[model samples]
Target: MPQVKGSKQYHMVVVPHRPVRRALIIVLLLVAAGAAVAASYYWGYHQGMTQQADAVAERDRLREEVSVLTRESEELRQQVANLRLGSEVDQQASDEMRKEVIKLEEQIAALEEDITFYRGLMAPGDNNTGLTIGALNVIGTDIPREYEYKLVVQQLATDHQVLSGYLNFNVVGRRGEQTETIPLHELSSQVDNEDIRLRFRYFQNIEGRLTLPEGFEPERIELMAQSTGSDRKTVEKKFGWLVQEL
Candidate 1:
């Protein structure tokens, strides 16, 4: 250590070597580099935390939306189930209505059959036999000429029974003379029974041609139908002749 005589100051201040100066500068630079690394580490950590928070919030929002969608799906499922149940109920009701209609139709048919049976019972004389005569028409315009007649008879009862009857035709001439009785049996051989029973009706469709004698003009014709039974009854019909020249 050199000092100046009679002075408090040192004689010469020693300068630092280049290596030491470099070492100091390296230390300062290392400290500054350490501070910069710390600051960068803190900034990066903060940024990472912020990003994590945003991701968590997004996840929660997505979960809430999923829950809402699940609830809506459940509601739609319930509605679909209700609709299916309603359809089944409607189908069952339709089936019941069809059954009721069929039952009503059967009842109506049964009633109609019963009414027909009762009507047959209330009728007179064997209850099932009936005779109907259509309109009688003369063949020609001349009097006492050949004539054609159509008759329709029906059996009201279901039983298959035959009926036998007789027809008598009386003719009156224009000159106040009466002809003999004309028997239907002489013209037809279809008589097999005397009394007509239940389900037995006689249908006499007689298409006959009769010749009149010369100089005898028929003024009126009388038809008598007689039925053989315990209580015999006869039906008579009279027809007037239209005069025409031959």
Candidate 2:
């Protein structure tokens, strides 16, 4: 090459014919695709994390609600149990009170009967004045074939004189299909004499424990009260053998 002054010079140079522009365009496109893929991944990750946090918070709230409900249910069960126990206690107390009331009523009835009996014995009625059999009671004991008997004889005379009499107690019943009469003295250890002596002005109660013979079913009891010597009066009474157990 020669340098010429004040004029344009033409020279020849060598250059390689390669596809540099196409390669540069391809590289730029690849870089843009990578940036797009990174952005999509980051967004997806953020969205997933938010959703997971929301799910965890919801699960905690549901657990708390379930715990509260469980506590309430337990309290309700305890209240029901206490109510049932109280009801049972009240029922037991009611039953005991009922039993006590029944016992008191029975005692009152017995006292009233005794008051009436004593009043009748002390005062004499006009037409009903005589030596008579007042009452008879037969009670059963816990031991089989054993019984206690009570007999009351009253003299209802206006004179109020001392009464001397002998009383006879007899039990009439069947011993294996045969009619039999048993004396009270033979069946009881307390009565030594066959005729029990009655020496009372107003009334006298004769009580004794007796044992019935084996297989002897008593149907009725017969009592005979007879006064001696001056005022000879005889009174007889009969009673069914209704045994009250003690």
Candidate 3:
């Protein structure tokens, strides 16, 4: 080496290519690890979104079920209320109908009595208009084999004298081909005497209780009224009789 009087020298450092290769490999590994982490984060976010959507759908279904139940409950309540109101209305209607029926029954009874009274006031003087049996009704009594009967005997003439006669009641029934007759007085307690005295001017209502034998079905009733005093006029009347127990 030869040294000069005014020369300057510089020192330089040399880097190896192996260190660069190692740094590049380290950078690539970091980039790959970061990419993998990003991919995992994205997949987790999508999974969370899917799970949230499923939860929302399930909540909507539950709400729908609750709405249906509420509607059904309200409908049942309305039906129950309607049934209660309907029962009350029906009872009121039935009560009104029953009252109207009772009133009509009373009116009918009053009209019948008035008709009987008017017939007595009006009478004819001619002899052609004689005694007549106006109405006959037989009702079953409370006791067995006993019945009550009412007979309305009317006369159109009272100018001659008061009608004085005797009444005979006979129960007639069919025994095979012939008709059989049994006296009512024989089978009766209230109607003890066979001959009942009858005295009236215009009309006479003869009411008495009658009795029949056990298992006796009378087909008809024969009523005979005979004037016992001066004129001796005889009148006969018949009525249908069906035996019934109370």
Candidate 2 to truth, TM: 0.58
* Per-residue lDDT of model 3, residues 84-144, tens digit only: 5765788755665556555645554554454444433243445545566667788888887
lDDT of 1 by residue, 33-80 (tens): 999999999999999888677656644654465556555545545554
Pairs that collide, model 3:
none
Task: Score each candidate by Cα lDDT.
Answer: 0.52, 0.78, 0.69
**Rank list by lDDT:** 2, 3, 1
What clash count does candidate 2 reach?
0
| Leading candidate by lDDT | 2
Runs of candidate 2 exceeding 4 Å displacement: 1-93
TM-score of each: 0.32, 0.58, 0.51
Question: What's model 2's lDDT at 98?
Answer: 57
Off by over 4 Å in 1: 1-133, 141-161, 176-202, 242-246
lDDT for 83 (candidate 3): 51
Candidate closer to the true structure by TM-score (higher is better), 1 or 2: 2
Pairs in steric clash, model 2: none
Instruction: Give the clashing pairs for model 1.
Output: none
